[model samples]
Target: MKVRELREHAKELDFTPQEQVRWLAPRQLARTAVKAVLAAVFAGYSDKREVQEVLDADLLEAPCGQPDAREIWIDYVADVGDGFDATSSVAWTLAEEELLVPRAIEGTDASPAVGDLRLRRGSLLVLGGDEVYPAASATAYEDRMKGPYRAALPKAADPPLMVALPGNHDWYDGLTAFLRMFTQQRPIGGWQTRQTRSYFCVRLPERWWLVGLDSQLGSYFDDPQLRYFEKHLSANLEPGDGVIVCSAEPTWLESVETNADAFNALHWFDRNMIRTRAVPGSKRRVPTHASVRLWLTGDHHHYARYAERLPGDPPGTGVPAPDSRRRQMVTSGMGGAYLAATHRLPAVLPLPPPGSRLREKDPPVAFARMGRTYPDAEESRRLARGIAVPWSGRWLPWRNLGFAKLAAGLHAGLFLLLCFLFALAEGVLRPVDAVRRAGLDDFWGFGAVCLGVAAALFVLGFLGRLLRRILRRLRRRRGAAPPSGPEVATARTALPPSGPAVATLSQALVALAALAITVAIPFPPSWDGWLVLLLCLALAAFLGAFVGSGVFALWVLSAKGGQVAEWQMSGQSIEDHKGFLRLRIAPGGDLTLYPLVLKTICRDWELRDEPSGGKRPVPTGKPAVRLIEDPVVISRGA
Candidate 1:
């Protein structure tokens, strides 16, 4: 396509259902957004004096003075670190606003990101996991995620309540980071601070009652979430009332047997057939009504829809076995992640086809119990809600070509590999055209052997690294000997107590390696040059695998503080924020602090005191911030 055509196409992908932006004056709104973002990005809101000063300083006063939206986005992009919810709130705002429109045009020659559009109009913006793609850190959130969402927000909005569900990605640094921002849902019991980031019902200006659930809360004893399910399932059984259930992982992708174990039931075979309303002393409080329609989910890296009849509530005998009915399950993880392929319809079953024909279910009960009718709207942790299924259910289906889908990251995967290999030839294996060079042939042989050895070492190194890491963590939990390494006592100076120093080192290594490979390739292609180029590329990859493994190690060690579990009024509505077993620990003897400050900047922990400067006892009130379950492992170095 022509360049203009390409730009036009790019604009098309950023498209959202256009509606008049309310609140802000049109032109003034754009200017305000740009300036506010720029101020928020580089400087923060802590110093209201400066924030307001910056906010008020008219960019138009100076020549080319007003900050452009793209510049604002770029500036906001710089401040993320291991700050959790604060960064999340910002990213959420950016994503919902569809603010990234200008950058989509400026940056590239490809289709815009789909999630770039704001939360659907009149639809409650439900976060179905890893609302923030990486750890809820400032660095990860702002740098890795903020840019893209900002680049996409011109067509979106924060849209009031974004019912967020936690995914492993949200908890990549641990559940606390995920919890810090989303106070409406608390981590369920036994699941640790791994709370049910789920909620029930939202009243948007639109008539629809938007009900949300945190699929991850399914891991507790006495599943209050389940009871809430029965309660709400019974109370809110309105006709055509839609439940836009958000989960990092989708229900249909779940395994029946595994789900049965999580919910402590026989099996949950129906796709999206969540067992909601249960009755007094019943077998299980499975919802019988089918009118609760529409399910939306994420985790997979594509936008897909399944318009078909789902299996009925497994435990409920009241409903006639659904012979066939209309239902749909969708995957909208396409917002941006590792993009994957749209699976072709005639997909062959990886598992054996069921041997026996399926049995039909009985009809649903006519009436649900009273409390059972309403979902527990409280942000309670007793609900055993979770997005727990094996890794296969959560991620197996999607491909991992970052934003490449918008820019050939998907289809171009192999071709990029070929280009990389070709670069190797240009650097290390050239002069084959002058085929008769005998000595060069012998040199080529030596290089190949070395390359092979490097490749093998790379694989072995990664494996050993992974095994050792696993063992080290296992030991930590067992309270055994520490991992074999000189503790970087000075890590505090180099690595903040919030995120990974080791992972940073690894990334630096890979970036340095890619740069080295590029440098190694002596442009016009000579035999020795090609040989060196090839060797460098191989070495880069070999080394990169190890560096990446180091990142994974830090990832495994990550933990953060949780969101407030319970809230109460301080008489005339000046509510005071309270407890959440909030703790921070540094594994390298220095500490990484992923602070759980409520609804603010995703930042490093600033000092905040525990309720009584005392040790943790069973908190009388729900903890607004909980302890980090894992630390973002870092390597302190000289």
Candidate 2:
């Protein structure tokens, strides 16, 4: 099933008005709140069981042998498993069928379809991170991961090797389901690459090695996993080999000030594994001439690529040098999870410098653009035709102007309603004489208070802007002297651009307008007026709190959900296509990445070689075949 077909399938699902309301309304928010509370209570127990089981198990160490061919292809996708939604599950299943399945039969050079790159049947398939979602429970794995992939790939006598690494989600259950699915020797649909431990190294053709690390729940590598890498290095590494390091999260992209702990393990790994250097004063060094050419990660739920050049290299170094001191960091986490926004990412990011001063972060401009939605020919054409006006009106000044006006009106109306209720509450609680003196009868007193509130908030906003300006000016004065250290550079980059004063003024105006509406409604001196006022006030507060909580919960799910939805609602939305990286390794150890978008599998399939009549084979194994309920044995050390 292609993306369009899957979209149609999604529409065909039993999504009644109520079901649609569940996802589009606050019902899902209530569900999330309930889940959050349950998770808080039950989450920690899973970790203890997972740790004990891993420590007790006699772990199998199965590093794959190098492929015979001079050139090898590898396809990777991470952060997969669409959470508990039937529609999303079906959509992701189609994505897997399109992307994971080989274009042509084995041992054949099939004619390529437009925009289609054929992958070899026996090519290695790597699940970079986060195999299941909403916590890595056994049921989640079966419903989201195992069942979908089994249907997509099916069991073959000879199938592609599959290896996976654990993301934070996988570690939520203490790696129980992750261990069972990947580490066990059993094949799921006949595509099994044996893994004894969570972390493993695979030797690709052409002196290339793929090392996947387990940055467990705390973003720290466990002692055993570190030891495993140490042993692997001692046994297999040689001088001048090219290495591709795979981690669950991109520590470099994280804010160093807030997430210092997360960076430590990645930094240590980089210095020792890639740079071939010892920790400060440790005097331990690996005997490898290999350099880390690429670092791949996928926890971000979007695609981004950053190329880091050696600090002293001159500008405009365009040519590709075989021995170039360049390392590429790519994040292709858009497997099947809720898509994250990349539109707001800064163009330049700070990364740790190479060698002994690895702790210091330096800003480097990324080569390729970073974003969730890349502009394609089709999207450009649609945008060029221009956005459709709402309500069938023509010649609007701007495409989104109508939406902005609607939103502003809604906000203003809501505020007006709240103020009226508050006034009514006061009238009901206090004596009519007491409230009457406060100008409940005349509009002036009420208007004055409303204006006063707006004025105070506006001044606060203005003062904030003024303070930021002062700080920037002081920093600039200090910056006259050459930046002497990393701290200065970091401080300069961290400061955000000053916001416009007009926005603050507009906000204040909106608040005043809302409050002003209350003055227009006449307040009677009777008990009936007091009762009506009180009811309105109570109802307003109750409804506001209920709705606010739901919106907040959705925001919590994905920080940019509200923004993404706003764009979609306004008809200015980008296409909802998720992508992954396809790395082609040349014999000379040169790596070329194809940023492959997942929409249709047959988009690249050749028309001439289209298969004839037979129905696609479906494996007869039970959908929940690998359900394991073994008791976790706790040892003294564990």
Candidate 3:
């Protein structure tokens, strides 16, 4: 049976704690983490693509849409489904804006013949990946992903086409729910779904193609997926054809620290499937090649574009090349997830990092980032301090209630552990008087706990210092510039060498202060004493949310590492800097990309009752949306 239409009788969705997926919540964190592990283990045993192949349900030859349509507009977004405020805000913006005309199309050449460019609502909506947060399920898709979209555009006669690529979160259930929602050729709200497989190829007008690849969890592609692409390209693709490859992850950006499985796979696909024509049963290529013009992805949760190094241009210059059709790697994952730090984006990205498979014919090319980032580097560094520094501007304890609770729980657990250790040391065995007696004897038990925590902090600080040193040496060896940005601005001060040392000392002091608060509670056997313990626990929880989070931030700053920098901002639950891509493929086969970004999501939503048993969200405060930069245009040159 077809899934019932959500728009007809849609119920109002509460965007509060009940509906939103708090990523760091204890239960949610444990469940998703365990499911991720199980999914990985079971993935090799059961491949969904292979199952489709066995059942002969593959959509390789499925009619995607009309291939001869001259002009088209597409809305592409990824990494969605966190909070309703963010998700619904994005959906509302897309739905409300019937036509988007940029304030000024400034980058192109000034010509009277060039008419004003108008971007209408995309007939095709491409959801790049991670449609829901934490995990994928029927309820998750309905509540977190599909429902918001339906409410945004409740009904439409000429509905837009929707296609999706599953990100890591979507694979937690082995893609069971993903296949059900996306591959069924059913209508989701006013949008129509036509893709018959997780991965698909859609030919556009003027010899341009949109290829969505499913690199399942950034691992190897199934044989069927690879063969499907290879066979399709060999049959339909011709020399000089332009291809826009959409993937779930931006492996090139991640290839720096992560294992090269995904990047290597993409490189192989680019070399064999798209770039070169292969001889039968041979690892050779013909001289004729299709132009793999743009690699569009969304794993990083930010907007960044990297263009191939031109012949005479210097590195790290954010200037657009004269030839717009050159290979450009763009990451636009800012659909509706927590904002990621943009300060750590490398000025220049080398295509194949060391240890990854090198390109067979061409040497490793340095791809320079073409323009400004979404939050911009300075703003990202500034935003990070609120999380890294205690009591900073953005460091309100209530920002992430889930993390605050988790922190409190941890501190409470620690208190219990200390009580157990104290009881073990003493001759007391009865559980009835354990807490009352633990602190009655002496301060030794509490003192020991403080010492242990301080010792751990010192150790962590030492390791961070060591890691920083290793990184500095590596940068010197590679002749790369040292890490800059506001977070590291303290290092350039007069006390440069003492930066990490001071940070370590401060962290130890904060830990002692947090522990001392709990130690101050007297252990009288009266009911009043238990009440005092409860008060002390509350204080401890506050300290955990405040100073505990700061300790982690200090460690990240001291380490001065990109991976740690990313972690520092992970739990913030920031609902700003959200973005998506609006792409226009003209009749002449020119691709114009508008990278639109919204600075802050609308928070106050008014719930209005709908006739279809659904509630619609109307924001009192309009979102501040703007283009990230001038539109990126890729022309089909003669």
lDDT of 3 by residue, 262-290 (tens): 37877878777877666778887674457
Instruction: Please report how far candidate 1 places residue 400 from its true position, in Å.
Output: 14
Tens-place lDDT digits, model 2, residues 1-638: 33333323322221110111122223333554555555455655544333532543332222234336677666677877753222233223332423333333222356423443443433567788888765677767765667546535555544556778888778766677888878766765546766667777777766677888876554456566666666565346566677778888877655332243445677677656655644435786654556677778888665666555444545542422222355667787766664444544434444442221344553333332222233232343333223233232211213233333334444545654535444564574433223333444454565566567767876787788789878888898876533234322232243222223333334444443434333344456565746744543443333333332223222222222233222222232222345556666766656665555543211211111113322221222211101011111111110
Q: Rate the local accuracy (lDDT) of all candidates.
A: 0.30, 0.49, 0.69
**Per-residue accuracy of model 1 over 391-489 as CA lDDT, tens digit each:** 322210111112112222222232234334433554545432222122333434534644565557666666776798798789788884421221111
Q: What TM-score, computed on C-alpha atoms, does each candidate reach?
A: 0.34, 0.61, 0.80
Scored by lDDT, model 1 comes in at 0.30
- Highest TM-score: which candidate? 3
- Clashing residue pairs in candidate 2, if any? 239-289, 240-289, 240-290
lDDT of 1 at 495: 24
Tell me how candidate 3 scores on lDDT: 0.69
RMSD of each: 24.1, 11.4, 6.9
- Candidate 2's TM-score: 0.61
